[model samples]
Target: MKKVMFTGGGSAGHVTVNMALMPLFLNEGWSVEYVGSAQGIERELVGSLDEVNYFPISTGKLRRYLDIQNMKDPFKIAKGVYQAYRLIRKQKPQVLFSKGGFVSVPVVIGAWLNKVPVIIHESDITPGLANRISIPMASAVCTTFPETAEQISKDKTHYVGAVIRQELKQGNRDRGRNYCGFHKNKPVLLIMGGSLGARKINEAVRAALPALTENFQIVHLCGKGQLDPSIGVPGYKQYEYINEELPDVLAMSDMVISRAGSNSIFEFLSLQKPMLLIPLTKQQSRGDQILNARSFEKAGYCRVLEEDGLNDASLVSGVMEVYNKRDEFIGRMRNNKHSDALSAVFRLIKETAKHP
Candidate 1:
């Protein structure tokens, strides 16, 4: 059987694309394996899969700021690379596909050292630190945004657009409403701040609930242990995080207020959910979320609300504005012609793989 190794982790954004594509490879009689940090969200997401083997590696955080961990991290990364190199050699996968993250950097380098072909997927408008470092070692770079091609070699970049999970489209709206105990008379709004949840977003949304729930029923994914049981508001339901019920919840949602993670925003875009995006501040990140939000705003897919200006009042106003202009956003989203990204990416990986 043809063999493939996938690497990416640290965040759900890094691993989601791999999760979307793995089943395709499995169905085609390929042996699919994953390499990621053991304690990361990727381990839980990929390890649960029965068909794919999961390999844990010692990965260090690739932080930009100065810290004591910086001194120790290089050694950890070096150890990870060695471990990855040996694993890749033993597994002898036909190709290595990386969805850029800190863990992926070592895996990509190991694949390069072993003379194995590597394909990378970049979801943001600009490459992340991990992808930027690994791009030179990759056989091809697949991009979600057309503009991303400018940063990489013309010959190596392939614009495949967003790869959406098929399960998301198969959600049942009624099931979602029943789960949330929300009536269909009022519009449903989903508030999510990535997988880990955003403290600011959760606080702001909770503070604005009196104003928001008067117009829209809300389902809030407040991250793990972030839910406040003290807030007993009608037409509002809160969960620490969602899993199997996510698609159903999304299906019932008429609009969204979320952090500007590329994978999530694209899913919202694909579902034509009018959105108000509050991207993480530059202080909190590399300013990628800011760029992601701006790109969506530019395309008329959503409205951007930076975290610096976020407050209960602003949150309420933003949601009101998006709710009123929801039709316009929906119209524009419907007009967008999404390419078959899953097919294109699958084809790219197959073509890039070496014939055994």
Candidate 2:
């Protein structure tokens, strides 16, 4: 049997993307294995799969500042690579598919060094640093945005759009409403700041809740970090995070307020949900979120907001504007029903297996 190793972690975003493609791999009779950091959210997410083998390695984020922590990066990379080499040897996978994050860096490198073919999926308008560095070693690169292709080594990328969970392959507005406790009279505003949560966006939403509730119900995914019952605003429900319930929350929404992380943005787009996106700006390494937000805004799929200009009033008005023109905004999303990336990725895998 063909053995396929998948690497990614840090958030459900990465895990969900890999899960989206599992059925196709199974149909092709590929033995699926996963490699990611032991501590990331993927550990729990991966536990549910049957007959799947897993390998854990140490991986850490690269901070932009020059600090003593930077000194540990090389050593971590070496240890992770060694751990990954051992894991890949045991699994003996013929191919490795990576969704870029710090967790996948060593896995990709180890796979390449072991002569295992590597395919990387980058889910952003600009490639993540891990994927960017792995481009030279990758046998193939897949992307959600065609624009990202230019940034990679030429001819290495296939624009497949972003992969999304199977649940969102089609949208159910009523199911979404029911899942979020929609009363049917008020619009539902869905807000998420990625898996870790965004303090700025959460604060702005909390500050604006009084006005937001006047016209809509709110289903907020506060990333566990912002789950403050004390900030409880009527007409709003806060959850630390919900892995299995996202489809229902998204389906019931009239519009969304979120960060511009590629996974969230694409999931919103796939569901045809209108949104106001706040791109992360504090760190230089976060440039991709800004670019991803701008790309979607330019496509007229969502309204993009910069954190610098954000406030309770501006956020409320932005939501109102999108709600007022909801039909037009959602029209862009409706036109994107066939934007699933997995179909194209599977095709690539099929061809690679034959050629290799």
Candidate 3:
């Protein structure tokens, strides 16, 4: 059977697109293997799948800030690169597919050393540190946004939009309402702060619960270890995280309030969900979320409420505005012809693997 290896980690965003592509590759009779850090969330997610070989490798985070860890990280990264080089030489996979993350850098370099062709996908408007490092080594780079393609070498860059999980489109609204104990009479509001949760967004939403619950039933995914037991109001429900039930909940939601991660916003666009986006500020991140939010707002798929203006009152008003203008937002989202790019991505993978 043909074989391909996937490498990505650090956050769920880096791994989700891989998950969307894996099943398609498997059904086509390719042997799938994964390379990631031993202790990352990717281990649990990828290891649970049948037939996919999971290989754990040493990894060190790439941080822009100064710290003692920075001094030691270079050595760790060097060791990781050597270990990945040996693994790639031994596995001899036909091609290496990478979703950019700190862990992916070593793997991409190792693949280059082994003379294995590599393909990478970047989900942001601009390349992250990892992708910037991996781009020159990759045979091709796939991007979610057209503007992102312009930033890279035209010969290698492909603007293929986003890959959304197929199961997301199979959600049942009735099942979603039952899962959240919500009635069909009122509009449902879904608030998510990515996988790790956003403290500012959570705090503001909790503070505005009383006013919010009056008009809309809410389902809040508050991230791991961030759930509060004190707020058990009638129309509001809280969860640390939801996996299988996520599609249902999304199906039942009339409006969404979320962080502006590219993978998530594209999923919302595909679902035609109107959103109120509160992006992570420069203080918290490299301002990628802010850029992602601005792009979505410009496209009319969502409304942006900056972190500086995210108090309870503003949170309530922003959500109300999204709810009121939902139709317009949905109309704009429906016009996104490139919302589902799985087919294009799959074709590229096949073509790349054939030469490799």
Candidate 4:
């Protein structure tokens, strides 16, 4: 049987695209393997899959700032490269598919050293530190944004849009309403703060909940350990995190208030959910979320509310604006040219594996 290896982790965003693609390869009778940090959330997610063989590797977090951890990270990364190289030599996978995270850098290097073709997918407008390092070594670079393609060599770059899980598109609205204990009378608003939860967003939204609940029934995904049981309002529901129920919740939502993670924003776009995006400021992130929000805003798919501008008043106002202009946002998303990105990515994976 043919074989393929996937690598990416750290955050849920880094692994989501890989998760979406893994089943496709498995169904085609390919032996799928995953390389990620031992205790990352990826291990829990991918290891649970019956068909994927999960291999844990050493990886150091890549930070832009100067820190003492930076001193020891090089040694860790070097060890990761060596470990990955040994694994690849033994597995001899036809191709390596990398979803861009610090964990992926060593895997990409190992694949290059083994003469295995590597395909890397970038989900942001600007490449992350990991992808920037891996791009030159990759046989091809697949992008979620068209503008990102211009930054790289044209011969190796492909704009394949974003990969969305198929299960998300098949959500049942009635089931969603029932699960949330919501009635059909008021419009439902879903607020997401990415995987770990956005403390700023959670605080602001909770502060504004009284006003928000007056207009919309709210379902909040507050990230792990961020939930407050004190707010037991009739029209509001809170979850620390959700998995199987996510699609249903999203199906029932009339609009979304979220952070501007590219994978998430793209999923919102594919679902045609009107969004009010509150991007992470430069202090919190590399400003990738800000750029992701701006691009979506420019495309007429969502409204942007920068992290610095978020507060009780602005949070309420921004959500109201998105709810009011939802039709316009939906129209733009319906006309999006890159809706078929999942298929494009699948084709690229197949072609790369065949040629490799």
Candidate 5:
């Protein structure tokens, strides 16, 4: 059997996208191994996955600030690269497929050093630094947005949309509504923060509870540890996290109010759900969220709202705008088609296996 290595961790956004490809890999009889930080959210999720080998490495996030933490990061990264090199050497996998994150960087470098063919998928319009560095070294760079292809080397690019699960592509709205207890006539608004809920978006939604409850029923995925009792809106249902139920919740909703995380953006598009996207602007380096929002906004499937732009009045107005033009949003979404990222990865593995 061919051995395949997948890397990326930190947020569920990266790992969830990786998980979407697992079934295809297994069906093809490929041996799959995951390389990621032991401390990432993936530890909990990937631990229970059957027939998949999980190898932990010592990856750390690179900080942009001038502090002791920044100084320590290089050491941490170097250690991770060493660990990854040893793991890749032992596994001798046929190919490496990376989803962009600090955790994936070391493994990508290791794969490059070992002469392993690497394919990376970047989910945002502005590629992450990890993806930027991996681009020249990678055999192929898969993208969710066609606009991002121009930013990378032309010869190495493929427009694969975002790798989404088969379940999402096949979810049903009628059954989803019954499961979520949403009213047939009233619109359902699904609010999400990547895997970790955004405090700002959660607080804003909580503050607007009274007004929102009157107009809609909400399925809010409050980040795992950040729930506030203030989110006790009458028509709102809260989840600490929703892995199996995500498609149902999303299917039931008419519109989504979410952070512009690439994973979430692609999930909405695959479901063809209209959205109001709030991109993070607090940090200087958070260019990916802004670009994800811009890509969908350009496609006419979503309206981009910045942090300052989303007060209670504007959130209400934005919801109304989506409600009024619901058909237009769906019409625009019809043009959206994500690639078979999992199948592409499987093909690459087979090709490498043949050569090996």
Candidate 6:
């Protein structure tokens, strides 16, 4: 039987594309295994699947800032590379598929050393630090954004578009409302701050909730350890994180306020949900979310609210503006075109493995 190894981790953004692709390979009678940090979010997401094998490796953050952790991270990364090299040699997978993140850098390099083919997927217009490092070692670089073609080698780039999980399309709006204990009397608004949670976004949303609940039923996925049990309101619900119920929650929401992660924004666009995007500032991130937000705004899919200007009042106003103009956004999304990314990428991986 053919075998394939997947590596990506740290945040859900890095792991989501792999999650979308894994079941395909499994159904074809191929052995699927994942390599990620022992305690990262990827482990939780992928390890829960019984069919796919999970392997843990030492990983260190590829930080942009100066810190004492930088001194020890190199040693950790070096150890990770060695461990990954051995794992690849033992598994003897035909190909490696990487959804680029810090954990993926070592796995890509390990694949190269063992003469295993590697394919990478980049979700943003510009590659992240980890993806940028892995691009040259890859056999193919699949992109979510068409504009990303200009940045990578013409020969290796494939504009396959965003890969959304198929389960998201199976959501029942009424089930979502029932789960949240909400009714159809008012429009529903959902607020999400990425995988790790955005402290600033959470604070602002809570401050504005009193005003927001008057007009809409609110469902807040406020990230782990960020929930507040002290307050209970008629039209509001809060969760630290959600697993199976995410599709349902998203299906019921009429509008959203969120951090502009590529995977998430694309999912929202596909669902035709009008959004008010509050992108992380350059200080918080590498500014990719800002670019993602701008592209969505340009296409009339969402509204952008930069983190520097985010506050209770501004959050309220942004929500109202999006709520008022929701139809325009919905119309644009309805008419938009998307590539069949899941099938395209799956085919590419199969062919790459065949040659290797």
Q: TM-score of the candidate numbered 5?
A: 0.92
TM-scores of all candidate predictions against the true structure: 0.97, 0.93, 0.96, 0.96, 0.92, 0.98
Which candidate achieves the best lDDT against the true structure? Answer: 6
Q: How high is the CA lDDT of each candidate model?
A: 0.92, 0.81, 0.90, 0.91, 0.81, 0.93
For residue 191, model 3's alpha carbon misses the true position, in angstroms, by 0.9
Instruction: Supply the global lDDT for candidate 1.
Output: 0.92
Clash statistics: count for each candidate: 0, 3, 0, 0, 2, 0
Q: Write the per-residue lDDT of candidate 5 for residues 219-320, one digit (tens) a residue.
A: 888888877765455678887777766677777788898888887787788788889998888484557788778877888989888887778878878877
TM-score: the better of candidates 1 and 5 = 1
- Which pairs, if any, clash in model 4? none
After superposition of all CA atoms, the RMSD between model 4 and the true structure is: 1.5
- Give me the displacement of residue 35 in model 2, in angstroms: 0.4
If both were scored by lDDT, which would come out higher, candidate 1 or candidate 6?
Answer: 6
Superposed Cα deviation of residue 84, candidate 1 (Å): 0.6
| Residue lDDT tens for model 4, 13-78 | 999989988998888899999999998878877876888999999999899999999999999999
User: Could you give candidate 6's per-residue lDDT for residues 1-356 as a string of tens digits?
Assistant: 89999999988999999998999999999999999999999999997679999999999999999999999999999999999999999999999999988999999999999999999999999999999999999989999998998999989999999999998988889999999999988999999998889899989988998899899999988888899998788898999877789899999999999999999999999999999999989997899999999999999999999888999999999999999999999999999997899999999999999986
Candidate 5 wrong stretches, greater than 4 Å: 172-185, 282-284, 337-342
Candidate 4 or 1, higher TM-score = 1
Ranking according to lDDT, highest score first: 6, 1, 4, 3, 2, 5
Give residue 319's lDDT in candidate 3 (0 to 100): 90
Those runs of model 1 whose alpha carbons end farther than 4 Å from true positions after fitting are none
Q: Which stretches of candidate 2 lie over 4 Å from their true place?
A: 170-179, 282-284, 336-340
lDDT of 1 by residue, 61-123 (tens): 899898999999999999999999999999999999999889999999999999999999999
* Candidate 3 lDDT tens digits, 1-356: 78999999987788889988998999988999999998887777787678899998888989988889998988888988999999999989999999988999999999999999999999999899999999999999999888987789989998888889898889999999998888989999999998778898999999999899999999999887899998779989999878779899999999999999899988998999999999988887888899999988998999999999999999999999989999999988888786448888888888888876
